[model samples]
Target: MATPSARASCPLLLLPSPPPACPSILATKRTQRRRRILSCRAAVRFDRRDVLAGLTGVAAGELGAHPGLAAAEDASVVSCPRGETVTDKLLACQEAGQKPCPPTPAATAAAVDFTPPTSPMRVRQPAHLADAETVKKYRQALAAMRALPDSDPRSFASQAAIHQAYCDGHYRYGGPAAASKDDAPFDVHFSWIFAPWHRMYIYFYERILGGLIGDDAFALPYWNWDAPAGMAMPAIFKDAGSPLYDANRDPAHLGAYVNLDILNTGDTVIPFDPQAVQNNQVVQNNLCTLYVQMMRNKKAQDFLGDKFCAEYPSTVSSGTSGSLESMAHTSVHIWAGDPGSSTVGNDGQEHTGADMGFLGTAGRDPVFYSHHANVDRLWHLWATKLGRSNFDDPEWLDTSFVFYDEKPQLVRVRVRDVLDAAALRYSYDDREPLRWMDARPTPLLPKGTAAATTRRSLLRGAAPAPAFPLTLTPGQSVEVPSVPMPPRAQKTPAAGGGTQPDTVLVFDRIEFEPGRSGKFDVVINVPPEQAAAAGPRYSEYAGSFATLPRGGNRSGETAVVALVLPLDEVLADIGVGDEDGAVNVVIVPRTQGIKIIRPPRIEIRER
Candidate 1:
C-alpha cells in the first residue's frame, strides 16, 4: 500500500493541533456568562416534558436542543429558496395538490425506563431460510409501520424522512455555513463515514420496527443476492397484498432471480434455472467479486474509504469510496429501482424514485432496510473474518450523527460507540464458510525475466509528475501525462513471480453540479471506440463516477467526489507494462445529454 505521503493530500489534513493554555479570567467569565444566558433562554422554551426529563436524573441540559430551531425561524428564512420550515414545505405541497406530506410528531419526554434492547437476538437469516411464522411476523411489523400516522417518528413515513434528511442534503446544523446561511446537507455516502453511518442508521431503524411490533427479538432478514439459492426477490416481500411490496418497483424484477454481476449493465432479467451451467458460473463470479471487495482490500482507505474531517466542506467528499460501496451497494440500488423512469416528474418537479433505486425514496420501500442489513453484515464479516480494522483517526471517532430513538426522541451517537455489532444486541444467523476463499481464480503473470524487466522499468521511470486537473466537457477526452509507479511497488513481489504489482488510478477532488444524473467512464490507453465498448473486461475499462440525484450543496456550490480504480489489473488484462511512461487517459460521457460542469483530477498510486 502507498505511504501517507504518497496518498493524495487535502487542506483538511491541517486540522487544529492541541490547544493553548487557559485564557484570561475576564474572558472565561464572559464565556460562562454567555452560556448562562443561552441556557436560560433554552430553559424558557422547554416544554413540561423537558422538566420531567430533568427530574428523572437524566438532565435535559445534557441533551442538546434541536440544532435547526434558530435557522428554522431566522428572518432570512423568507428569502430561503425552499420553505423555511419542513412544515412550510409540507403545506406548500398540500396547497399545490401534490401528494400530502407526512406530519411531524410533537416532541415528548422519553419514557423514564426506556433503553435499547440489551439481550442478544439470534442473527437473522437470509429471507429464503426464514420459517412461515417468522415471515408472518415480519409482514405484521411492516403493516403496523404503514398503519402509523406520518407524525410519529417511528411511522414508516417519518423513518424514511430521516434517511432523506441525511442523504438528500436536507438536514442542517451549526457549522461555518450556518451562521450567515443554511449549512450544507449532511451525507453519509462516498467517504469513510459510509459504514459506521449506515450501521447506526439501521440500528435505530431496527429498534423502531421492533418497538412497533412489540418484538424485541425481531431481526431484519437479509437479501442474500450473493448466493444462487437466495438470488430471487424474497417471496415474502413479493406478495402483492403485503405492506412490504411497493408498486413503483420494476414489474419484471418482482419474481425474477437476480444476476448480481449484470446489475450495472441493466440486464438483470436472467432466466431462473438453478441447474443451468450459466447460472452457476454467474454465482461463482459474484462470490469472487465479494472476496475481492472484502478480503483483498486490506488497507483502511481502500476498504472503509478516505479520511473525512470536520473542516472538509460538506459540499465536497474528502475521500474515495471503497469497492463495496461503489459496486455492491450502488448496483443493487439501481437494479431494484425502475430502470426506465426519468427522475423528473410529470409536473416537471424532481421526485425521488419510490423504489430502492434513488437515494431520497430508498428508505420509503420496506425492502431497503433488509438490503442494507446484508450490506452491514458484509462489514461485520470484513472486521471479524477478514481481520480488517476500523480507522483510528480521532476526527473519525469524534464525528457524530443524530437519530430518533425508539422513544421517538432524537439522540446523538458517535462512531466510536458502534464498532461492535453485539453491543447493538443482534447478529446474523450462521451460514456456510466462505466458499470463494478456495475457488478464487489463478493470478495472471508474465514470464520470469519479463517480470523483472517490468519492475526495473517502472523503478527507472519513477519521477514524481506535477498534478494535473482536467475539465471534461461532454464528449471530450483528456490524457494525463507522465503517470508514475510508486518506488515502493517495485520492491513488492507479485502474487506469482510474473504477476503485476497492485496499482490504482485515483480520481481526486471531483466537483460537479448537484442533482445531475450524469456519469463519466474512465478508459486507459485505449481508442475511443474500444473504450466505449469496454464491458466487464479490465483491459480497456476503469470505473465510472455515478452521482446521486439529491444531496448537492443547496448554496449552489460544487461538491467534490472521489473514486479509486485498480490500474495494475487493467494493465495486466491488456498486456501493457507499467514502465515509466506517459499513458493516455480518456474520459467519455457514459450518460449522454447531461453535461459535465467541472471535471476531476487524476493520479496513479500503489495499492
Candidate 2:
C-alpha cells in the first residue's frame, strides 16, 4: 500500500491530460466574473468518490491518441515570461488573468529547512478577559500582518491561499496531468478531519501573528461566542481603524449580541432588539447546545465524525458531521460574516458573501482565527473534561497536511502530532467548569434506576404511529402530527439488571436540493406562534439541516441524509414524556437571502 505522502507526491501522474484553452485571465471583467461563478458551481458538482476513483487513472493511451488533448495537458510545461512554469490547466486559468500565478506552494522544498516549535506559550483568554497588554500585542501583530506585501508567504493573502488550496482543490494530484481533472477538488470540511484540520490551521496562524509582533508568548484570543457576556462581537475587533476590522462585515452586527440559534439565516442582517428576556433565553439555550454537542455525544463517530478515506475503493463522504461542527461551528461562521455584502456577484440573488459567509473566502477575515480559536478550545474541553478520546484509526493518525511555520517555511504535520495542544506549545487560559451541566433539570428517576414494577408487570407497549413525511420550501414551514415513543423506550425494570433504554428521534431519509444553501430548523413540541421561540434552548429545540455546498454538481439528485437526536434530554427538559407520551415536530425553513427551488423531504422515525 502506498503511503499518503507517496500518493500525494505524484497526483498528476494518476490523472488525465489537461483540457484545451484555459479561461483567459485577461478576459473582460464581466466574463471573468461569469467564469469564476461558473467554475465554483462546477467545482461543487463532482462527488468525492468519483474524483478519487474514476479521475485518477484515465488511460494515457487515449490521451496519447488525441494529440490535441496531449498537448493541452502538457501546456503546463510551457514557460511563461517570468521564471515560473505552468503546472496545470487550473494554473493556466489563474495565469491567464492579470495576476501572476506562482506554482502551488509545497509542504517541503529542497531549498527550505523546516522545524517544529520546541517551546510552549501560555494560552490566551477570551477577548473580553484579555488585559490591555495582550490586546495591544494582538492588535499590533495584526496591523503588522496588514502592512506586509501580498507577495510574502506570511502575508494575509498567502495565508488565505493555503486555506483555499485545501478547501477548493487548487492543488492537483500527480503532476501536469492532474491539472486536467478539475473535478477532483480537495475539501477538508464535512469529515472527521474538520476539527483537526482547523486546529492545525489556527495554530500556525497564531504563531505567524505572534512572530509578526516579535512576541513568542503571544496567544490568539477566542471569540467566546458561547457565553452571554462574550456573545457580542468582541469590542477590540470592531474598531473601524483597526487592522483587524473588515469593511465587508454586516454593519448591523458590528457590536450586536450573537444569537446562537437562528444561525441558518443571516442573523447579522436581521433586526436584533436584544431584549433582556430573549437574551437570557438565548444564553441558556447556547449552554444546552454546548452540552449536547460536547458531552452528550459519547461515541467517537458521534463527536469527531465518520472516518475519512482518500484512497481507491474507499468512497469519500460529506461524512456525518458531528453535532458541534454542524451546529455551533457552522452557525458561528454564518453569523459573523455579512449576509448582504457583495464580495462575489450574487447581486439581485439573495445570499451572503465575503470573509465569513462562503467557504472559499472565509479565511480572509481576521476574526476567522478568533472564531476557530473558540472552536479549538471547545475541542480541548471535550477531550479533557468530557473524557473523549481521539480516533485511533491509522488513516486518521497518519494523514498529513502542509502548513507554513513561523519560520515561514512550509512544514508537513500529521494529525497525531496535533492531538495535544500542550505539545504544540500553547494552552488556553484556565477557566471555570461549565455551569450548564448543573442547570439541567433532574430526571424523573435517576437514569438506570429500576421501576417499582417487576418485568412481568411492566409489559412492552404498542408500536409508534407510521412514519410521516414533511416537505418545506424556501421560507415555508410544515408541522407533522405528534410521534409517540416506541414500546422499548417505556420505563421498565431491566430483564437482566441493565440500564434503562435511551430513546432517540431519528429524521430519516432527509433530502435537500442540490446547489442550494437553504437550511431548516427542527423544533419539537412548539406551537406555530412559539416556533420562533424554539432554538438552542431545551426541549422545544431539536436540531437543524444545513447542507454543505454540493461540489459543483447541480444534477438535482438529492442525497438522503439523516439526523439522529437524543430524545431523553429533550423529554426531561420539557417535563412531558410521562404525561403526553407524544411530541409534535415543526420544520421551519431558514431561508432568508437564498432560495431553495426544490422542497426538502423529512421523515420522522422513533427508536
Question: Best-fitting candidate, measured by TM-score?
Answer: 1
* Tens digit of per-residue lDDT, candidate 2, span 1-607: 1122210110010111122322332222221111211101000111222212211123223222222122223422111111111122222223222222223322133223224477656586888778889888888988887777776767777666555444433332222322233322234554466777787788878888888977887899998776656777788888888878877676677756666554543453333343452345456666766766766665554566544322121111234456767777776766677767744311112335566766656777888888889888887777776666666666566555555666666565666667777777788775634655544533333322211111111123212222233455545555543333333334354576643444555443355543345467776655545565455544456667565332222233343344555556565565543334334556667763332222221111211
Clashes of 1: 1
Runs in model 1 deviating more than 4 A are 1-117, 176-182, 257-268, 275-285, 309-319, 340-348, 432-482, 489-503, 516-529, 532-542, 551-558, 566-589, 593-607
Each prediction's TM-score against the native? 0.68, 0.67
Worst 10 residues of 2 by lDDT: 7-16
Clashing pairs in 1: 123-427
Write the residue-wise lDDT of candidate 1 on 1-607 in tens digits: 1111222111000001111321111111111111100000000021233222212222324323322222222312111111011111111111122221222212112212223456556468888778777788788888887787765666787777656545554432233322332222335565677777777778877777777878878888888776667766777787789988876776677766664444333453655564563336456656655655665566656666665421232231234467657656666676677755535421244645445777767777777888888887887777777666666565566455555666566555656656667766788875745664544333222323323433343334422322334454554444332233332234356565642334555454455555544466676655444445443323355556665455324334455555556555555544555332323455666443333222222232332
Query: lDDT for every model?
Result: 0.51, 0.51
**Model 2 stretches astray by more than 4 angstroms:** 1-116, 169-182, 264-279, 309-316, 345-351, 431-433, 439-471, 474-476, 479-516, 524-532, 547-562, 571-586, 592-607
User: Which residue window of length 10 is worst by lDDT in model 1?
Assistant: 35-44
